[model samples]
Target: MFLISMIIWATALLGAVMTVWALTWAIKRGEFRNLRKGASSIFDAGEPIGRQTDFFPPVRKGVR
Candidate 1:
């Protein structure tokens, strides 16, 4: 019985510590600036900044 109780307490303590650590790291990294920032980051803004065609140019036919 004692072993079971100890295991439960240890699990609870570990979960609490992880929660606290994640919150602290997020606060330090400015993750809470705005909720939409996370969603917006998934989108692309117009064309890419660099030349993308360099890697994926169209192939010419009968050029050989």
Candidate 2:
């Protein structure tokens, strides 16, 4: 019982430390500087913004 409690506490502490470290690293690297660009990184010229290009398998054939 004591050992299980210690393990859980240690795991929680480690998770919190890792989360803080990751946030700090991202801040130092300017990862959050360009929010809009990052949000649209997956899009391309062929698939412009506000345009729905993807269709599910069942609805794909009927689209065209």
Candidate 3:
């Protein structure tokens, strides 16, 4: 339908405009200067929790 096509075209145009605006803003604000400064800060403190579970016995396929 004509209405559906027009809606899709409008959406695509709006998305493209927003993406360009974001990139330009980032460049102007120097947000891309530090590429990896804080990239590893999340894992710098400690490992993830609750990966080990000895509370329950291991699965036995032959019995259960």
Q: lDDT of all predictions, in order shown?
A: 0.81, 0.93, 0.78
Q: Candidate 1 clash total?
A: 0
Give the per-residue Cα lDDT of candidate 3 at 5. 100
Ranking of predictions according to TM-score: 2, 1, 3
State the lDDT of candidate 2 residue by residue for 1-64, as single tens digits. Answer: 9999999999999999999999999999999998999999988888888899877767566596
Instruction: Show how many residue pairs clash in every candidate, following the order shown.
Output: 0, 0, 0
Total clashing pairs in model 2? 0
Q: Where is model 2 poorest over a 10-residue stretch in terms of lDDT?
A: 55-64
Q: Per-residue CA lDDT of candidate 1, range 2-53, in tens? A: 9999999999999999999999999999898887867567556664344353
Cα lDDT tens digits, model 3, 1-64, are: 9999999999999999999999999999977777686464444334534344346777888975
Off by over 4 Å in 1: 34-36, 45-64
Candidate 1's error at 15, in angstroms? Answer: 0.7
State the displacement of the C-alpha of residue 20, model 2, in Å, after optimal TM-score superposition: 0.5
Best by lDDT: 2
What TM-score does candidate 1 reach? 0.56
Q: Give the better candidate number (2 or 3) by TM-score.
A: 2
